[model samples]
Target: MFRRHGLRATAAACCATALLATPALAGSDGPGAPGAGDDYFPGYGNGGYDVSHYDIQLRYQPTDDHLRGTTTIVAKPTQNLTAFNLDFALPTKSVRVNGAPAQFSQDGTELTVTPSEALPEGSLATFVVEYEGVPSTVEVDGIKPWIRTSDGALAVGEPEIAAWWFPSNDHPRDKATFDISVAVPDGTEVLSNGVNTKNASLAGWTTWQWRTTKPTATYLAFIGVGQYEISTKTGAFGQPLVTAYSENLGELAGPAKASVERTPEVVEFLTGLLGEYPFEAQGGLVSSEGMNFALENQTRPTYSHRFFRNGANTSVVVHENAHQWFGDSVSVDTWRNIWLNEGFASYAEWFWSEAQGTGTAQELFDHYYASHPADDPFWQTLPGEPGAEEVFSKAVYDRGAMTVHALRNVVGDEALLDIIRTWVSEKRYSTGTIEEFIALAEQRSGKQLDELFNTWLFTKGRPPVGEATGVPVSATRVAVAPPKAVAEIDRTHALLHDH
Candidate 1:
C-alpha cells in the first residue's frame, strides 16, 4: 500500500537513521483494539457490539455461480436499548431472527437488520440471516483480481470476500467464531478458517465444514474454492493443517509448499519470539491472482502467485502471518488506527529478515530510511480520518517498522520480545491501543518512552538526526551591492560641501 511519491526522497535519509536510534516507549492507549466498544466518538454510530458470536453454515455451488447460507448470530446488548441494529455485508435474500421473520434494510454496501424486540443489556439474543449472490470479483483501489500465469493460481485480497458469499460484518473490528460449511462443485476444493472437521460430497457437490474455535476478525475469516491440491503438515501443539494450491502449478508450488511446510517452524520461531500462535488452525493458500499483495486472513492465508515463485523471498507471507497475532487476535478498533495492524505487519518483515541473516537488523532500518520519501505527509495526518488509507501509507509501514527497530535497540532484543510475547498472550481475544502498547513497552523496558514517541509520532517530520542532520554549517560568504552611479556620487559630495 506504499505510494510511490517523489517527495519521499527528502525524508528518506532522515527516517533511516532516526528509526534505528529511536527508543522504546510504554504501550499507550493511542487507539482501541478491534471489537472493543467504540470509545472514540460516542453516539455517532453503533460500534461493533450487539453481536458476540457468529455460527454460519453456508453452501456454495461454483457451477451455478450462486452462494446460499444460514448465519445464526448470538449478540449481547452493550448498551441499554429498545431496538437492536446489526451490520451485514453483501446482498442478502432472506433474514429472520429467532424463527420470526425479521425486517431488514440495505444500502447496497451494507445490510442493516432491526430486531423486533428490545434485548436488555447483558442478555443474549440470536438472529438468523440467509442470502445468496454471485460472488463479486475482489477489487481494491480499482485493481481487479486475475489468475497468475506464474502458477495459474487464484487468491483473494482487499477484505472480506467470504462475506461476498455470506452475510456478516466486513470489518476486522468485529471478531467472532464462524462455523463455515461450504458446498462446492465435486471436483473443486473448499478451504476456510479453523481445522477441517468434516468433508463430504452430497447432491453432486462437496460440502466442507470448518469449525473455528478461536475468535477471529471478520476480515480474517475466509474461504478459497477452486481446483486445488492439498499438502499436510503439523505445528506446535501437534495441530494438523494443510496448504492448498491449483493443480496446474504443481511444479511452482515448491516455494509455497516449502513455506507451508515451514509453517510449524515459522509458528515455533514466532511463538518462541513473540508468543504462541493465537488461532486454532493456521495454513496458507496459493491462488493465481497477481494482486498487489497477500492477505493474512486469520487461519488460512491467501497468497498471490508471486509468493509461490520466490518462496520466502516475498515477505508478504510473513507479514500476513504475523497478523494472526496483531490484527486478528487483538484487532484494530477502527480504520484510523490501521497502523496498529499494518505497522506491526511491516515490522514482522524486518524481524524475519533479521532472522534469516540476510542483513543485520540495522540494515533493515537503513532500507526503510533510504526508501521512505522525505515529503511523506503522514506526519501531519490526523488520526480520525474516514478510512485507513492515509494511515496505511509508507510512513506508517516503514516508519512504524523503524519505530519497532528503535524500541528493540532501547529495550534490547530479549526484553522487547518478552514484551511482545506478553502483549499477545495478555491481549489475545481482546483489543488494545497505542497508549496501551506504550504502557506495556515501558513496563517491560523499565524506561519512560514519551520522548521517544514524541520524536517519531507527534512531530511534523522525521526527527533531526546524525545522518540527515539539520545542523547549521558555517560557510565563507560575500555580500555584493550595485555600484553607485556617478550622478549619486556627485549629489552626495554636493550635500556634504553645503553642510
Candidate 2:
C-alpha cells in the first residue's frame, strides 16, 4: 500500500513548465492509465501520477440542487504523459494543465485531459478543472452517491463519492490533503473534513473554508451543506473539537448530541489502546437526511440520525471514532483489504463495551461465536478475502472482529495491545494489508501466528467450540445477545442504503 516517497516539485515550479509545446504521441510519451488497477473496482483511481493536494471551491444551491466548482489538483506524473484521466461525473466546463488550456473529453465518469504540453515523468503538474451540474442527476450504474437534503446536499459515501462532487484520483491508494471551500446561502451551514478555518459572508452568501492537516483518502473527504446547529471546543490536548447536528433532526437532536458530544472521551480511550491520535482535529456529524449509514469521513465522522432514534447510542460513536485510528489513519491497501477497516472498528465497539462494564469482550465474542452455526453462511465468506461484491457483508464486520479477538487470545492481552500500537504507529497516514498486519503481530508477539490468522480470517467455517476461538471452555457465555445499543452497531452495515 505504500508507494515510494519521491521528491515533489512545488506548484509554482510545475506551472512554469506550461511554456513547453505539446508533443506527438510517440517514443515514451502516451496517455496515463485510466485506473489505479485495484482488484475490486479497477476504474477507481488514475495512474501515471500521484496527487498531493486538492483545492476545491464551489457554490451550491439547495433549491435546485445545483453545484458549480473550480478544483485545482497538484500532482507528479509517474510517467511521461500526453493525456491523463480524472474520475469525475459532472459536466466539465474547462480544464487547464500547468496553467495552459488543455483539450478535454468526458466519457461517463472518466475525464480525459490532453495537456497543451506533455507532462514529463518526475515533473509536477498542476491541473485546474471547472464544472457544474445537479449532483443528484449524475448517475452511474443507477446509483447516485450524493444525498439531497431538504436544505442542501451531502457529499458522503465509501469508495465512490468524490466523482459525483469533484474530480479526483478517487482511491484510498492516492491519499492527499484537501482545502474545501463551499459557498452557500448565508444562513445555511457548511461542514467538511478537518478544521473549519474561516467563514465570511457577503451579498447573502457565506463561504466556509476547511483544511486538512493530514493526508485523506478521496472517499474520506466530505462536505455537508445545510442548516446545522454547530458546536466547537478545544480538546484536553488542545486539538479542535467540532460537531454539527442538522437543525432538521427534530426529536433525534438531543440523543445525537448526547452521543456525539462524547467524541473527545472516545478519542481519549482509543488513543490509550492505539497510541496517540493521528489527526490534528476530532469530531462527528449527525445528518437529518436519508443516508442510512454512518461514514468515517476523515477527522469528522458523519452519522444517520437513525443511529440515535432509540436513545443515546455511544456504541455507534465508539465504532466510528475507532475508525479514526484503523480506517482513516491506517487505510486499507485495496478494497479487498476492507477488513483492516471494518474489522478493527467493530472490535473497538466490543472494547468499549468491556470498558463501560456493559459486557466483557470475551462474553461478546463467545455469544457471536455460539450464535452463528457452522452452516450459517456467515462463516462461509472469508473476511480476509471477501470479494468486491461482499466487501461490506456481515463477514467483514462481525467475523472480522471475531478474528481480532482470536488473535488477542493467541498473543495475550499485553502482546496484542503492543501489536496494535505498533501497527498504527508504523502505518499512520498510509495503507496496510492483512499480510502486513499479521507479520507485524507475529513480530511484536514473538509467536507463530500464520495458523491463527488463517483460521480466523481465511478459512470460513466457524472454529469448533474451543480455546482457539478466543473463548475458554469454562467461560461464562452471554445468555443472549448484548443490548440493542451494542448489537445495533453490527446491524448498521447490513442496512446501508444504496449510495
Q: Which candidate comes out best when scored by TM-score?
A: 2
Backbone atom clashes (below 3 Å) for every candidate? 30, 0
Candidate 1 has a TM-score of 0.77
In angstroms, the error of model 2 at 391 is 0.7
Worst 10 residues of 1 by lDDT: 470-479
The digit string of per-residue lDDT tens for model 1 on 1-499 reads 2221111112443344334323222232121112222322111123324456777776665554555677887765554344333444446777776567767776433455655664454666677887665454433223333222332223244442434544554455556787878776687787777888899987787788888877776656667777788876675678877788766565667766766556666666667677778777777777654443456777777765554553333455566678888878887665456666766777776676667755555655554444334575644543223233344444566566666776776677888788888888888887777777878988988987776665665566654443222111110111132122212211211221231
lDDT of 2 at 451: 74
lDDT of 2 by residue, 212-302 (tens): 9799999899998898999999963789999999998999999999999999899999888889999989888899975877888888999
**Model 2 residue 482 lDDT score:** 62
TM-scores of the candidates in the order shown: 0.77, 0.92
Each candidate's lDDT (Cα)?
0.58, 0.83
Looking at candidate 2, what is the lDDT of residue 268? Answer: 92
